[model samples]
Target: MAQRLGALDLLILLPDPELGILRPAPGFRQTLPGGSTWTELLGRCAGGGEFRATIAYPDVQRLSPADVFITPDGAVLMLIGGQPRVRASELAGAAGLVLALLRSEAREDAASASARASGDVTRRATALASSLDRARADLAKNAAALRDALSDAARLNDELRLLNETLEQRVRNEIAERAKAEDALRQAQKMEAIGRLTGGVAHDFNNLLSPIIGSLDMLVRRGVGGEREQRLVDGALQSAERAKILVQRLLAFARRQPLQPGAVDLNQLVRDMAQLIASTMGATVEVRVELPDDLPPVTADANQLEMALLNLAVNARDAMPGGGMLKISAEPEQVIPGKSHRLRAGRYVRLSVSDTGVGMDEATLSRAIEPFFSTKGVGSGTGLGLSMVHGLALQQNGDLAITSREGAGTTVDLWLPVSGAPAGANDGPGNAAEPLRGSGTALLVDDEDLVRMCTAQMLMELGYRVEEANSAEAALRLLDAGLCPDLLVTDHIMPRMSGAQLARLLTSRIQDLPVLIVSGYAEADGVPAGIPRLCKPFRQAELAASIAALMPTTAIRRRKDVRQ
Candidate 1:
């Protein structure tokens, strides 16, 4: 009933009605919008005339040219088709056939419309399915992104929790460290206060003993030749000497001793004392001295160092009882600034004494360097050895460290700052110094009557004119009153202005004046350096020697100006 025209069109099987009538389809004498219509075509081919025409309807595109024919019932049939060069006479017998064909075309058109509607529905269903798939994919992506975001948030929370915990722990540690530092500072302050108190007591005690020792020395020198007298004198002198030793030990522990620091060869000093150390530790104990040749010189008092070594050896021997090995070594050490506890940063020569013997416990080791903290039996030790050594090290701007475990041996390290100069063999006390006598006008100053009396007598006995001033203030008055002497002798620790200050003031008035200082154990904070100092609890021989030494250095600037 129909033929395919293209993909979306069809051609109906029917002859044109206008061809059968030999005219255009009937109309009411009207024209198509585009210029031509069925009415004009009919006029051209009326009265069964043999003619053809084209009617165009540009705006009505769906109004196709219709094939027309008359049916058996005299009804007109119209369909869409085309025939080329057909006469109007030929359409009379073809009407029934055309009508039948038109009927078939109507059925075909109905079937085609049904198929097109089905196709439209199928296309709409496909588009909906694709849109649904896209929506599903988008939902899946959104879910995955949500999951990823949650995971990231979880990780961030964990990191924040860890950071918070770390900050809390760090804060706790900082507070603990701050508390420890404060406690350490308090302890240091307390120890310094105690040290000052101890030093003051020791100084006063020495001052008290000075007169007794001076008087005894003078009597002994005056020739007490009787056997009983000599023995008693000797005994008294020995006792006085012991007391002086005790005072000196106290001063050493207090770190108030004026040290005569010099460049010392630690290697040579240790080597020289090895024999004595071996003998003193007993035949059972073996002494080993390891002094490397390359070690630098240390600036400290050599005698104090020797005494420290002897003390360490004695301690080690006592710990062994039966026997042990005493190892002594010297080497260089490096210290960092501000970080080195109790010592300034510098290159130091470490003199270490290692002993293989019964070591001390933690409690004992903690107080090992404390004065009077001793484990030795009664009358066996003075308990001031290690304390003295500690003080000596500190006085030299150094530090001491002791490491010991309960059963393992002990090691004592003495770290002294290294001297710039190379080590020198300055051993063997220089030329046995004897007491020298000199006659000159001497200015003697003291705050105490007894010590001053004893000293003045000793000077007069040595054949010198002595002038006495009870105090620095009184001495200044004497100088103002024009009492000039050949030698100026003064006690260091005096009331009001110190003896050193007085000497400085007097030196300004009298140029090239010889000043001699007599001290017990005082700090050199106010005392001027390069001035000769004589320690108290001294004998006439020592006093004479000290004065003799100062006499050569401008003792009598103007001999004629002496008053006494």
Candidate 2:
């Protein structure tokens, strides 16, 4: 049975290796000299030789049968692929006709020679001429048959050429279609990433705002409800403090958070986080700290590093919902250039948090550090935890790497660059004090009206007569008019002129006047060096400390009316 495989109407054989020998061939076969190769043998056999054989399937270990037949003009037909399009009977008939023409030509040649040699007079001449006439007529009939055969071959050739062109076009169309699909997939991925970022941001902010709003709303109702009212105010303060942390994390991810980069003891940091991890992760999850005190110190923000550790701990807790061991360790490492995108070539403190839990697969692990991507269900977690840690590592000239195996465990490595200097004591949260008061006027600038009003009120509580400006240019106008204040406090991000640009301009003109830039995050390089900065959503006490640090020239004026 003929399989009739391949789009080709006819295939000419030329022996070659498979995989490498998957070459295109023209339909016409050319006779090669007698050889052992299948193609050569097929040609010889088809040249009216009595032979038949099976051969190897081009370099592959299989046998394919080949049938051969010779054409009148000494061409071979290899039906190796068994294509049923060309019929053996019809071709054989054409071959027979061609054979007859050859025979007639030979006979005519012999007759001409004999007639020339004989001295025949009138009778021989008449008989020879009649025979010549009959032969000429027969030659003409064969010539017409040959012409029809040539026309058929030409038509077949045109069809094969059109098929080849169509096949090439289809291949090009397939490539184009695949490219379009890939582009679409990339775009969809980008949009999904954006959505995750926005969702997580909103979630973190809303959670922080909920408690603060609830507490303040209760405190503001009617009169002071005594102790209950105090508790409400306390709750509001706690919520606001938490909100500040969330804002700092957001700033860190943006690479705008200012870090007080100094030598930090990795061993001590891990030790401190152990108890927190144990308590927070519950009894089912065990906590372990493996840190060598001899490990070198890494340059980073102490508070931010602590925050990062806490985040990793929380992440471990979420992973091990069924209980597992969480290990925190620190060691020295030397990174190569381009080894880690965040850290360059340098000695670093490798701080790691590993957990024995059901770990992440490749797909989930890849997007683990992406903002708002979390395996935990909504309301269970904000996906920003690992992302914030990643951001902190980057801001501190460090890199964050994750290793995980499904159903085995996960490990997050924080490679922080080592500093030669010894670690210093970090600031502690002390008892809250009254807002520092000042006699001189102060200038406050912000783009938002409500924020400006609130900040001005805080300054007023601090006993400074506050002036307001909606923008940086407007703030400069106040100065141009000779309305000099003790200090300048402005927003970091703004339209037209940013706080950093405004600060540079003010410093040149005001000479000694102090400036404070307040925002969620300021670009690490953009803000001027050595100017004191206070983060946004701050308390009156924080505002006082910042103002006192910057504007020492403003004479102290204690407000007796301030509540304890």
Candidate 3:
């Protein structure tokens, strides 16, 4: 009947009444995937409970017969088939007939056992006890296997959860890093555009200011007017000086201002400015200095550094309207490559100004160094303080760093490279005495009529016969026409030939001719190396000092005689 039904061989499975689990009878081997037992597989099936009920109650009338049937002795008969060749009802009837035969055989066995019951009762009891012991052993083994499987599944789940969390965190970090890089690129581009525009405007402004400042300075020094008139001149002069300072600040932010970089003693500079800082901060604020005695000198412009410090102090004072502690400190630092985006790997001295006051939020701090971006009320600030400092740092191969929190405080650090040379003796303030007088022909060349007239007057006032030229070519023509000047002062950035180029050409032609190249901006390649330079909008005294430094009294006299 099994062969006719096209099913696999019929198997009889007995239900363990004690454990309520199914076990194939001995000599039957059935295996499932992952080595799971048939008992575990069937227990997880949807109809598993009903199938077990049919096996346990074999004596009851069979309600429905399907692929599975039961015998009278609590045995399950399974017909495993890929496809049945006959109807399911026919199979069920045939299985019933088989079950009936088995039931009859079970009854015969029971009857035979009863006949021998008196003699074999003790032996029967012994056999049944041994089978119970074997069942107990099998149950213990199955429980241990289930426990190990559950433990493995739990461990795997924990590892998977941890991996997902780590991946999420890494993704978040990558996104944050990308955002920071984009912000930096945008900032650099904006600053570059502003610097170019500011630099050009400042250059033209400096030219116009030179003659005004120089004329006003002369009028004030020589006492050319009455008491009331003098006061007016002083007022005008004072206003012009203030204008000069503002232009310088703009130039500094543009990175076009010339800087006289030298080794500067940081400790001494801070000590000298302590009184000034205290006075500026006023009585409400407490000022503290924390500079180490053994601090190394840095390479920077002394005057510019002082100005930067003053600006920071003023900013701190404004931040603390109700007054707070302002701390100035310096320390040495070493940076390695790839450690910083703006700084190169080297030794640096970190000069920091920290204030206990209302600080900036992330939005404000991001644009703190942008030109003309100020939080102060109208007319209270120029908004170039931080940007000027930042430009100074970049010009000097340094960097600026800022840290701030909304309600905490702000710290600004100016990191400058450590100077290899010791601080020079001439790095201090200049002498306040009168400028030296010279007796010789001094050539003054500039393209602007007002600037040339103003500078020539300053030269004539210095006791030298002044020769004026409107351009470098004109100056060259004067030299070619047998006019030998003891001193040659020319303005840089003129048409046709620059001051530095003219100086180079004249030096090759004449010997012992002192040349001073003056300009508004710091054109590194515009001027030849080893030539003396003077920044534009110079006072009579500054001009005299630069001239005297180049051509001393003895040198000037000697050069005049050689020309004679």
Candidate with the greatest TM-score versus the true structure = 1
Winner by lDDT between candidate 3 and candidate 1: 3
Global lDDT of each candidate: 0.73, 0.68, 0.78
Off by over 4 Å in 3: 1-176, 425-439, 555-564
Which candidate, 1 or 2, would have the higher TM-score against the true structure?
A: 1
TM-score of each: 0.71, 0.62, 0.69
RMSD value for candidate 2: 14.4
Candidate with the larger TM-score of 2 and 3? 3
RMSD of 1: 25.5
lDDT of 2 by residue, 1-564 (tens): 123322122333332344433122322333322235565564464446434456554334555555555454444444554444444333455434334444454465565567666643455556556655665566556545655775798799999999999999999999999998897688557745654464356334533443354335335443467887678777766766666666666656655566778777777777776777689989999888888869987788888888888888888888888998999888898888888654688898888899998999988986787766789987887677887887778777778889999999999998888988877644445535444565767788888776677677667767888899999989878877777676788987788998888888877766676789876555666777777787656555567777766654446433221111
Which runs of model 1 end up more than 4 angstroms from their true locations?
1-139, 223-232, 334-342, 422-439, 552-564
For candidate 2, which ten residues in a row score worst on lDDT?
1-10
Candidate 1 C-alpha lDDT tens digits along 1-564: 112211111111223566553322222122333445555644443333333344443344534454443333434333333442232333434434334444544554565566577766565545445544654565456445645665697799999999999999999999999999997788677667767887888899888999889888877887767888988887898999998987787888899986788889888888899889988998888888888888888998888888888988888888888788989988898888887767788899888899889899978986787777789889998888888888888899998899999878999999999998666543434433544445567899999899999999988987778899999999988877877777888898988978899888877777668888988875779788868888888988788777766666332445444332
